[model samples]
Target chain A: MATTACFMIVSRNDIPIYEAEVGTAPKKEDAAHQHQFILHAALDIVQDLAWTTSAMFLKAIDRFNDLAVSVYFIHTRLMLLHDSRNDDGIKTFFQEVHELYIKILLNPLYLPGSRITSSQFDTKVRALARKYL
Target chain B: MAPVAPRSGDVIFASVERVNAELFTLTYGAIVRQLITDLEEVEEVNKQLDQMGYNIGIRLIDEFLAKSNVSRCVDFKETAEVIAKVGFKMFLGVTASVTNWDAEGTCCSLILEDNPLVDFVELPDTCQGLYYCNILSGVVRGALEMVSMKTEVTWLRDMLRGDDAFELQVKLLKQVPEEYPYKDDE
Candidate 1:
């Protein structure tokens, strides 16, 4: 069975603004909360690496056995977790998401560091996942 | 005051470099769409745009000063001229005309003939209260505030809203004196 990809958008304040799961990875009981815990735990490693490197794309920053985590940071943090080792696919997905993220920032009503609850934004993210993830 | 030379804008712009317009436009488009979806009220959106622009402006001035190699202006009029001729040209690759001065000569308008940020953009009916170019006003306000000038920057007209042209009215409210909190005990 193919492992599913977990995508998360964490705000500057460390709150997860958007979260989605794509692909058919066999689900285990309590996997949702487990994924959240894994993502949050990885944040500490991400923070430590950020001070040492200037690259926006931090590939394979951490891993737990078969699980690999990729991190991208702009004004906020984008984290991707997957079992596969396709670095190129992960980079492309982050690029498209970054473009969408900047567009959201342009809205007069949308402030930085706030939760993104727009359905339109959610739809666009799903489409990108289908195309790339 | 007498009008400055027309080609000054051209001279300043020619010396300045350029960036890919697509990156600028697409980024701006995404921001506008996001703002519409997140904020339900138009008035709130307007205020937010100004606030955001102010933030951008504050930092942008530092870059403008470093790259343009221009000195400080003696008065508000000169400040207006530099912003129109140099600041806009350097950043946006376009020069706005400084016009419509008030009687006290402390207020003026920067009339923009073209704005690259709103290229291929049309205001949807649902976004009636949206000020598409409000960030520009905020930028000006924020940049000026950083220079110790307290100015009220407002939009007089916006082509994105179907106005005849794009105009930003900048008024010099008062000069804020720089307060030095740390002083040696004498």
Candidate 2:
């Protein structure tokens, strides 16, 4: 049994949109069946964040790109669900992400590349997952 | 750009600016759409819209600050000038001028030289709501409050009245929150 919880907060609306999953996986395999669920879950999280506020919606464009890369980096063998093979400027996007990551770390309110693990937000996400998928 | 047809009290050469129009339309759409969905009473919808616009005004002050890189206005006239020039020009693409400033200073008139939103659309005779214009009032009140001014916004003409020109009444009152968070401690 493997359970992972993740959560995100929207700054403008002060609302938390979350998604979590609890399922049994034989192992974290390359292109594993459970990994598909995780990718789907992450996409749902990104989509909800987009809908929360106008500011958040604009911010999500950048965050979604970063998250796609992060997921790939975390599971080197798993291709991202949203990866576009034809999407040009992959290298430039990565460079920009690296610069932004540095900026995020410099910000007192945030830490660089830290996975969001707010328990309250995760609880809401898990409840939604249980209800829907 | 060609000069817009001037209203009775409007500032000459009222011009449109893209940034202001984008911010205004987006904010107006967001507030109106939300009110129509989440609220039931017309009065409550109005209240919520005003309040939302107030907060938006507070945030927009920051935006104006960042974009214009200007310090606080020295007085209400200066404040009004910014509202006429930078504020409206930034958001609505129109410049309004003060006319017939009241002795109490609580009542002033704004003549619109041109209005993009009003162009090509006629307000039905039955219509009563202020709609997009109230948001501008909220922005003015909130932004001015940062520099210590208390004001109320009222309309002098209903574009719904089928008038070629538009005007709004701005009533300025005694200052509130005379100092800001960063103000020097006396």
Best by lDDT: 1
For candidate 2, report its TM-score: 0.44
- TM-score per prediction, in order, is 0.55, 0.44
- In terms of lDDT, the poorest run of 10 residues in model 1 chain A is A103-112
The candidates' interface RMSDs, in order, read 7.1, 19.3
Model 1 iRMS: 7.1
True contacts kept of each: 0.04, 0.00
- Candidate 2 is graded, for docking, as incorrect
Pick by DockQ: which candidate is best? 1
Candidate 2 per-residue C-alpha lDDT over B1-186 given as tens digits, one digit per residue, 9 for 90 to 100: 443322221232233234454455444454554564566455566666667668888788777666553456666665666677666666565677778776655577777767655432322222235354555567677776766677787666655354555676777777776545575765
Q: Which TM-score value belongs to model 1?
A: 0.55
Q: After aligning candidate 1 to the native by TM-score, how far in Å is the CA of A94 from where it should be?
A: 36
Q: State in Å the error of residue A86, model 2.
A: 55
Angstrom error of the Cα, residue A95, model 2: value is: 52
Residues A56-120, candidate 1, lDDT per residue (tens digit)?
Answer: 99998888778878899876899988777777878888999999887777644455677776666
Model 1 has a clash total of 5
